[model samples]
Target: MMKESLCEVNNLGLRYHRGESAILQGLSLSLFKGEIVGIRGENGAGKSSLLKAIAGLLPYQEGEIRMPKEVRKGLSYLPQDLSLYDSLTALENLIFYGKIQGIPGRLLKTRGNWLLEELGLSQKSREKLSALSGGMKRRVHLASALMLRPSILLLDEPTVGCDEESYHRIRDLLLKMKQQGTGMLLISHGRGELEDLADRILTLEQGKLREKCISSD
Candidate 1:
């Protein structure tokens, strides 16, 4: 029997402003459960835009996006831009996002602490985001995204600016999530990382989607 797709995008099109040429045009793809789908392309190849559309962060002008309603309920997105509160600590940031995501109060506290410890931020849990380095901020942002235990994860340049240790931690965590049957849409420019982690690689060029098979080492 064939595996059911967690996500499907067909003839998707989007433009930032009216009459502007579509940033993403006729893009189509399917992502299955327990798979890490990587989107790779040049700087302006609409990789980020495609992710935004799938994540419901951007409105598309055309086409269908199909997903299990339950999976859609569990979707979590981490954008390339950092959006943490400058005055809040790493743990506080996680708590905020968790609460907003409807995580129970008791579970939020417990999960926040656990995530901070796991991400190696326990020592600086009280330090304000303003005091953290760029890499640290990125880690905090990623931690917030993981706090909800999302079944479908959409990550845009998740490892960008991360230190080597932090990068490995994030990479390993993603692998573990995939093993647990989480569907992922990963956008990255790093060929090495994509080659190592993605189950299927999709390239967007001139508004077209192409799949590239990658060997798993």
Candidate 2:
């Protein structure tokens, strides 16, 4: 069976200002549910810009990004910075984000607990973000995103600063989400994470996305 496509980007173009060089142009991409796709590129490449456009955080002048009316309501975005609250505990942060995502009050508690436990952060549930290690913070960040049971996830460098165990936990959590039918678009510069997580990998250069095979190197 063919999977349903959650997002469609057609002839996309992104520019900061009129009469300036385009940051990205002639880009098209499709994301389907129950899949993981990775995009890799060099420093100057517009990988982050592309993610911003897809998330509707940035305006695109010359293209269209279409999502199903029904499915549009359940998309989650995790930016590169993680954007977590530094002073809040992991549980508190999850509750805040769940509420913001419009999850029901009682349900938020249930989902938040499950997410924390599943991410192997049950012990750190009450730990302040400032107190938790880098890996635990990343897990908390991901927990916030999954709180609303999103159908698709947009992740940027999800395991960048994670320790070995934290990295495995996040990777495992992603696999679990995939089994339950969540589509994920993650960007990473390293090949190890992409090689293990991505079903399809693309390299972005000069505003173009080219499919690429992961090398053993």
CA lDDT, every model vs. true structure: 0.87, 0.87
What tens-digit string does per-residue lDDT give for candidate 2 at 1-217? 7778999989999888999888888988888888888999888788888888887788988889999876678888898787789899899999999999999898987898899999898888888899999888888998988997888898999888889999889999999998888988999875588989988898898888998656442
The C-alpha TM-scores of every prediction are 0.93, 0.95
Across 1-217, the per-residue lDDT of candidate 1 in tens digits comes to: 6876899899998889999988888888988888898889889888888888888888989998998899888899999999899988888899999999999998987998887777777898999999998777877888899888988899999989888888887887789888888889999986589987998898888878889988553
Considering every candidate listed, which one attains the maximal TM-score? 2
- As a TM-score, model 1 comes out at 0.93
Superposed model 2: Cα runs more than 4 Å off: 213-217
- The C-alpha RMSD in Å for every predicted model, in order, reads 1.7, 2.3
Show model 1 residue runs off by greater than 4 Å: none
